[model samples]
Target: MPRSHVALACLVAIFWGLNFLAIHASLEQFPPLFLVALRFTLMALPALLFVPRPQVPLRWLVGYGLGFGTLQFLGLYSGMAAGFPTGLASLVLQASAPFTVLLGAVLLRERLTARRALGIGVAVAGLVLVGISRGGAGAWWPFWLVVLGAFGWAIGNISSRLAAPPRPLELTMWMAIVPPIPMLALSLLLEGPRRITDSLADSLTAQAVPAWIGLAYTIVFGTIVGSGIWVWLMTKHPAGVVAPFSMLVPVVGITAAWLVLGESPHLLEIIGGALVVGGVLWSGRLVAARGAADPAGPVDVGDPGASAHAVEPAAR
Candidate 1:
């Protein structure tokens, strides 16, 4: 890949990394569930109206929406609001890579390399380390919630693999259509209509300015623009060459949270986070090496919405 394209890939990582802070800001004023519903609602509108439907099956699209659109944000926003450190949430979500590989092996009968298995073990160990460090201090649920969100993201990766839509960005946009109604229903059931109404009513006020800005950043930059560049890069290069760039996201996330949010993570969390990123990068490097050596090997390293039984990019 050219240096310019590689930089574009890194740029996507930065956008997604900063997206965690955006979500944290948006959750300050919007109820987590309602925020999930609203995020998708706005995203789905332009896609449904102007974009052509992706040439994919309905079931896979629905599955993508449920897992990626609905379950992902449902756990992520709630977890962050529940006090999961933004930096840690970013770290934990990388677990989706191993989870996707594991699920693909089990559900899709995909074979895993020894390196893949080892990478997964290291990532899992990292999670355990973080869990022990946090749980020892009596704050554990938030960590688990983000893990659940990561699992949901893994599920989305699986559905995306199965779907294998021709136009990935269009498919991703259409997948947004599946989550709004269900998420809205969930918001009504859990957060209540009063909470939703109050959030909307307050949106016009000065207090909601930051929240709206955060939401716009998330929708435009995080998902749309970030995924757009990701898809374009994948089209221009081999998947293995392109996929490893996502590991940069957690690094960017941690730094952004620490700098902007004044978050200072414990040493243990930092160590564990390093292990997680190191493991994923180890696996990603192996993939890249394999692809370079054998042109016929697995070329499908999963991007945000384009893959088939491929590796995950911590697609948040």
Candidate 2:
């Protein structure tokens, strides 16, 4: 990657990190499921109109949508609404990285070396500490929901690997078309027509301006610009060179939440988040080193989400 691309990678990380604050803003005015529906609906329009459909099988695209777009955001938005902290949401969502490693080994039949195993174990331990910290407050369920979202993200990553679309960015866009209908149905079923109407009605008010802006930010920067640039960089550089920059996201997330949303994390959460980032970076580093040692190394796709975030450490 060129120095300019490196800066772009960091820019993507900042956009994604601040995306947590945007989600929180939207959730203040929109139902979580409904937000999921609307977010994707806004994104899906481009897919329907402008973006070419990825050449992968239909099932893979749908699976990518369901797992990455639908399930991941469903759990994520729901958890945030249930009072999961925003900074931590960014941290916990990273569980997808380790989950990807595990799923790749079991479902994809990829080899999991001892170093990878150690990394996963360390990451999981960090997660467990974070979970325990919340459990001490008897509000652990929301934490699990975010973790489930992370798992959903991992599933989406697997689907992306299987899809192996020639245009990964198009795959990202087309998958957006999957979430709106299902999530909207859920919103109608769970959030009710009255609430949906109320939320929409509320959107016109001056108080709702920030929420609308946040929504636009998420759709434009978070997905289109952020993920688009990520996939572009992935296509251009080795995954190892690209993957480490992703670690910056939580740093920005936590810092932004603290500064903007006034979210001060628990000591345990800080420690745990450190472990999670460090462990994931460690695992990614080992994978890159191994690949560097052997340029003929087989490709192993890894990721946070096909939407993640994009290019996995093992993709090289």
Candidate 3:
């Protein structure tokens, strides 16, 4: 990879990392579902008009949308709104990688290698420690909700793989069409119409500036710019070369949360986060090794969607 492309990749990681803080900020002004609805609305408009629909069937698109857009963000935003810390949320969400592997073995009948099994075990242990740490801090419910979000993300990864669209980025943009109305309906049902109206109105207030800024960052930088650069890098380099940079996302997320949001994680949370990241990296290494060992096997390191599968944000 060119040094320029490497720099671009790092920039994408930074955008994605700071994305958690954006979610944390936006949740302060808009109800979780409502904010998510608006996010998809912005994502789908204009781009949906310009980008051709992916060549996949409607069922696949719908399934991907529901899993990635609706379920994933619903749990994530709600968990954040429920007081999940930005840094910890970033670390915990990495559970999606192992979750995706497990789901693939069960649903797609993919083989589970010993290395992957060991990685999964380590990740699960780290997750348990994280849960215990957070629970001790009185954030049990929100932590679980984020874990649910990670599972939704895993399901979405499978859905995307099943869809196998020729253009992954276009499919992602089109899937944006699926979330707004349903999420809005959910917001109305759960948050109540009155609360939704109040929040929408309040978004125009001075206090809501940060929220709106956060929304803009998510829509523009996080989704459009970050995904665009990721797709570009994938085209320019092997997926293995680009995918590891995604591990930096949690690093940036945790650091940004600490610096910008004044979030200081507990010592246990820090240790657990290290274990989780290490485990995920270990899993990824095994995948790369498998791909190398059998070039004609199922693993396709050049697949455009591989990076998305590994690190694509739910809100993204």
Q: Rank by TM-score, highest first.
A: 1, 2, 3
Per-residue CA lDDT of model 1 for 192-264, tens digit only, reads: 9898899899899998899999999999998778866765554454333454466678899999999999998
What lDDT score belongs to each candidate, Candidate 1 first?
Answer: 0.77, 0.79, 0.75
Model 1 lDDT, full chain set: 0.77
**Weakest ten-residue segment in model 1 by summed lDDT:** 300-309
Cα lDDT for residue 146, model 3? 87
- Clashing pairs in model 2? 302-312, 305-308
Best by lDDT: 2
Q: Which ten residues in a row have the lowest lDDT in candidate 3?
A: 307-316
TM-score of each: 0.87, 0.86, 0.82
Report the Cα lDDT for residue 21, model 3. Answer: 87
Candidate order (lDDT): 2, 1, 3
Residues 1-316 of candidate 3 have per-residue lDDT tens digits of 4446658877987898999988888988899999999999988997578999888768767887888778888988998889988888887776766776776666555556676577667877887898999999898999999889877767666666666666767877888899999999999899998988898889888999999999999888877677556644544433334444555678899999999989998888888877776875676575545545654422533343444444333312
The alpha-carbon root-mean-square deviation between model 3 and the true structure, to one decimal in Å, is 5.5
Runs of candidate 2 with Cα error greater than 4 angstroms are 1-11, 229-247, 290-316
Candidate 3 wrong stretches, greater than 4 Å: 1-12, 225-247, 286-316
